[model samples]
Target: MWVLVFFDLPTETRTERKVAARFRKNLLDDGFAMFQFSIYMRFCASRENASVHIRRTKNNLPKKGKVCVMQITDKQFGMMELFHGQKEVEPEQPSQQLELF
Candidate 1:
């Protein structure tokens, strides 16, 4: 399971800038890595784990601007295509899990 967070917060004012920085730091402290300038991603042990992190993200959302959260399976995330100079490249898929039951 993966949790992706996308946010765009107002940063024109000094206080707004501080709020944005604090939000980013919170995401980092929560184990999310920066995928883009304002996008962060994290791998969760399970769907429920992802949900917990998602809730945390919601709680820290900035008072202004837009925010979006998305949950995706490893398989679905693998299908994401990246384009560079007109060439389409699929993202590397995560290794198969070895579950012991």
Candidate 2:
């Protein structure tokens, strides 16, 4: 599963900019990578793990902005089409994680 976060936060004021930066930092700290400037995504091992990250994203939402959270299965994510300028490109594959007991 994948947990994706989309946000549009107010950044006209200094404080608002700070808040926006903090939000991005929080997402990065929580294992999300920047899919775009306003979109962050993280791959989870299971739906339950995705739910945990989704809850964390909800907990740190900005005070005055729009935020959207979405979850998609690995197959769905793999079906995405990516392009660079006029040329098509392949989407990145998720990294394999090691589990140790």
Task: Give the TM-score of each candidate.
Answer: 0.81, 0.94
Q: What lDDT would each prediction earn against the true structure?
A: 0.86, 0.92
lDDT for residue 76 in candidate 1, whole number 0-100: 77
**What are the root-mean-square deviations of the candidates from the true structure over C-alphas?**
3.8, 1.2
The lowest-lDDT stretch of 10 consecutive residues in candidate 1 is 90-99
Give the clash count for each candidate.
Answer: 0, 0
Model 2 spans > 4 angstroms off: 99-101
Residue pairs with clashing backbones, model 1? none
Clashing pairs in 2: none
- Global local distance difference test of model 1: 0.86
Q: What's the CA RMSD of model 1 in angstroms?
A: 3.8
Q: Write the residue-wise lDDT of candidate 2 on 4-75 in tens digits.
A: 999999999999999999999999999999999999999999988888889989899989999999999889
